[model samples]
Target: MKQFQNNSLYYDVDVKIIKQSEHCIFYEMRNDEGKGSIKSYQVFPGIKLTYNDFHMGQCPYHNPLHKDILEINHCREGRFECNFINGMYTYLGEGDLAVNTMVNNRIIDSTFPLEHYHGVSILIDLEDAAKMISPILKDISIDLYILRDKLCAGDRCFIIRAKNSIQHIFSELYTIPDEVKYGYFKLKVLELLLFLSIIDTSEQFEKRTYFQKNQVNKIKQIKQFLTQHIEYHFTLKELSKRFDISLNSMNSCFKAVYGIPIYAYIRTYRMQVAASMLLQSQYSITVIAGNVGYENSSKFASAFKAVMHISPSTYRKSH
Candidate 1:
């Protein structure tokens, strides 16, 4: 039932809180521009949430309020920093989570240029929460109690996974009918709470495994960086420098994670962009080539043929 006032100068904002439960609710908000803007809402209380995916070089800031909300951030892509109270700072990369509690908090900063960050947040409304938990049975109370403790403990990974799952659930709410969406949203919220609850009881989820998780995180960051700056010609060396990894490391990571090298990935991404432009826009082949980071038309043609198995002109003709 809380109203959000639009403070963003970039666009008009509208937010809708769809469903509310003892723990969380569903919500949606949309920005009018639809460019670098998102509108979403959820009924999960106790968190004032802000989810943003921005271009490189932009630093987004949220000034601390007198009454602090429990803040959890997961960097799905790119890199950034969280500046806390008393000048404490933490750098977060993909798969990394950061937590700031009301007790000790400050501002957040993004360190990389042309970076993107996507994550979710859950703010606990303590006063309302007490009333909600009063009616639950002792067994159920165990989990809720544990979750509450961890949030107070400022468990970073726990918060990240919980918020990430809730955000995914919120995204799915948009497609379903109101009744079904509400039912599903509540289920997801419960799942998130239970996940947090288990985290409180067990220490297994806190340990980072070297399996695909770390590589997956790096891949997400690289892919997102590529998607946002598709027009720029990205060399392996440049990408390595941008991500603070070596060329061999970058290539191995991409190949192991994506089943392709960085160049092949970029080429495919470029060709896909070119195909969309060819079909959606009236830009000529030369312009499209330039737009996709190709300088020579013939070179672009060969690369396009290698990927699509057809020349750019032929592909255009077919489409």
Candidate 2:
């Protein structure tokens, strides 16, 4: 475990080493919230690719800023939340790519707004990675230092929302044959860096949504209220007045934080609860629909089918 701490990938976080082989290391962290595991592979010297699968709400990471390290993250599922030193909150939804170096932007901690996140992080020690640039490709050149400067110029952290180029690069990584995993990862990492190197920073960046601390807090309160009282429906105006936030701000901030609008989130949430009731409890479809805020069984059946893709009776019977 102590030896693994020296790895730039886990240097700042306190992770227990579960096991390690010649080229890969497995680490796990568990607390009251939940458990998570990180499987890291040494793709290249001073360059490592880590697969992060977390089932907890938050993971505490010490702010051990390393200027030589450049971090690239891709959110494959769920939502990633982090507050920067500037007191602003940023999020990464599915298919989003975030590039930042600790020197320019410091990540205070790792948080999953949805309580579970699956993603990938590529950690590059600029100095070390530069020294090990493979000579296998004669026509292509990769300079880690130059890449960092280009992407994280000044205090900027380059972010790209879901795009076809990003999708093309990372989608295959999630599903690779084990026999070719190591070799496949090297190819993908090189492809990603190459893509970043040539990308036009001015036109390719996404307009990232940054929320104020107060707004985030209030929206969280709104979310808690809505989830707790799923039996009732609230309009955007009603929630705005109840939470004392502007209408536009409420809609955008809620979408930014939770990756969905308030109504969509609550609708999915209600169906989820109703789903559990259908399976766990001996409740009638009408009773279950009423519990989730539907007065008319026909209307509830329509909404449930729209969300779950099956009628309530059929869903219950299928299981």
Candidate 3:
């Protein structure tokens, strides 16, 4: 086990390497709050699989450590955000699957909601992956290397629709017993590769979208602005004028980065703040809702129920 300071959130992270072999390396990660336990398996020269069952409050920003690594992520239980080197962010909600990479050691930021997040990740090294699949390259036009380079050529990402095949592969991983996990693990990786190899046409690989670093940063600034002024409401036109961007561009960019419209992000943040107040303060429900930017209790309750699935009083009492 070893310890390191995560620069992004200024928190300590602990890692325990359970095994390190030429074919596979197994490890686990936890944060100081005991809210996280992420198990990882690095398979040989090219592939890695991770199962995340943790609640690391707000994980700090960090770059991918591998060279030429490409990631496929599926969120099984909770949602989070993935920030790329180019400043863009993607949301990984339950059942959402995505592939992303920026080639090398460039930084990628991550944010987790304030609860347990369970997910699975599969990473592939382009060069090594290409070599492993060389035997099949002679017949197919889409080499994994070519697929990565041409498809992701730049700081790129794709939110793939979760098909039954991908879902089945991960569902098995979640349920496989310890006795045969290793063999099943290898089989699943092969199955995943096979699925990727045949699922898309050459052009379909290029269909995904990405955002710019400056644009992403702009949205981040807007998020900070909203956080600081939670009681105040801003409209799309107001935000666009404030940021000196077009309305359509702002909407698209904001959705691309944060995975929701601007107002949805605001409401989510407001409810989260309301939740904290409910637990930590003696404020009345109406007062708490007002403090979090709601003018009417009924409206607040409806909105809260939409995101939290419970009434404020119930949530407060339960906690």
Candidate 4:
């Protein structure tokens, strides 16, 4: 295993290159939170496609190495938080897409809200890509600079919520045969850019909610409190009073951060906990239900089926 030192090309202190080949590099990062790996493939001149898989809560602090670069990210699973330098935060959930230039709009912090994320990032070295792409096919024109201006004008990050057109382009990327991956990547990248070029920015740009730091902190605290005492259920009013935040703000911010409502998140979390206990322990379903704040085993079984798609007994037996 050769070690690609931190800060060598584009990485900061939190990552190291674990493997490398002719046209691919595998980078891994580990910290107190957890670990992740990025598999990068050089497909075209000044353009690369990277598959990002992280089991950790936070990514390594990113410091853009290139001055002229455009990053397009597609979230295939989990939620991603982008903390801007202007003291604002936004998130990218599954099937969402984000387009931005690293020069003007910089991300101060990047984290996975659910502590796990699987996604794809296409990094374009603007200067080099702009010069190289157009001449490849005279009939189809691709101008990187124009695409940047159209998508990320005024340093604003352009986000498109999950649409079938975008999904059609990205879904194939996750499952490509190794022998044809290199050629398929070129075709797909070009297809994506062509689609973006003709995209009506006016209709595609979504009004994303941005949360303030103070509100985000309070919401996080509320999450920790609720998760720590998962055996108890609390009302929105009670949580609002305990956290000293308004009721409406709590709902919106929690959804923004975790991509779900408070009731839904906790219910899913409790079921997950119950599922784990089911497999790992010899505890009966009634005891497990009570531990997760469900007084009735029948009710617990129903909820577990709703979330886990199987009864607690069946789930344990299958696993």
- Report the C-alpha displacement of residue 179, candidate 1, in angstroms: 3.6
TM-score of each: 0.50, 0.92, 0.72, 0.94
In lDDT terms, which candidate is top? 4
Tens digits of lDDT, candidate 2, 30-118: 88899888888888877789899999898546343366788899999999987877878888999999988876436666689899999
Report the lDDT tens digits of candidate 1 across residue range 122-238: 444454444554454345653344454565554242324324543454465335575565456546555555555555435334343122334445655988899788778777777
Model with the higher lDDT, candidate 1 or 2: 2
Minimum summed lDDT over a 10-residue window in model 1 is located at 4-13
TM-score of 4: 0.94
All predictions: root-mean-square deviation over Cα?
8.2, 2.3, 5.7, 2.4
Model 3 spans with C-alpha error above 4 angstroms: 1-37, 42-46, 53-71, 77-118, 124-159, 206-208
Full-model lDDT, candidate 4 = 0.88
Clash totals, every prediction: 24, 0, 1, 0
Candidate 4 per-residue C-alpha lDDT over 195-252 given as tens digits, one digit per residue, 9 for 90 to 100: 9989999998767557888888998998999899899989999999999999999999
Which parts of model 2 are misplaced by more than 4 Å? 1-5, 8-14, 60-65, 134-138
Predicted model with the maximum TM-score:
4
Per-residue CA lDDT of model 3 for 140-192, tens digit only, reads 45467665654455555666654676688788789889888777877787776
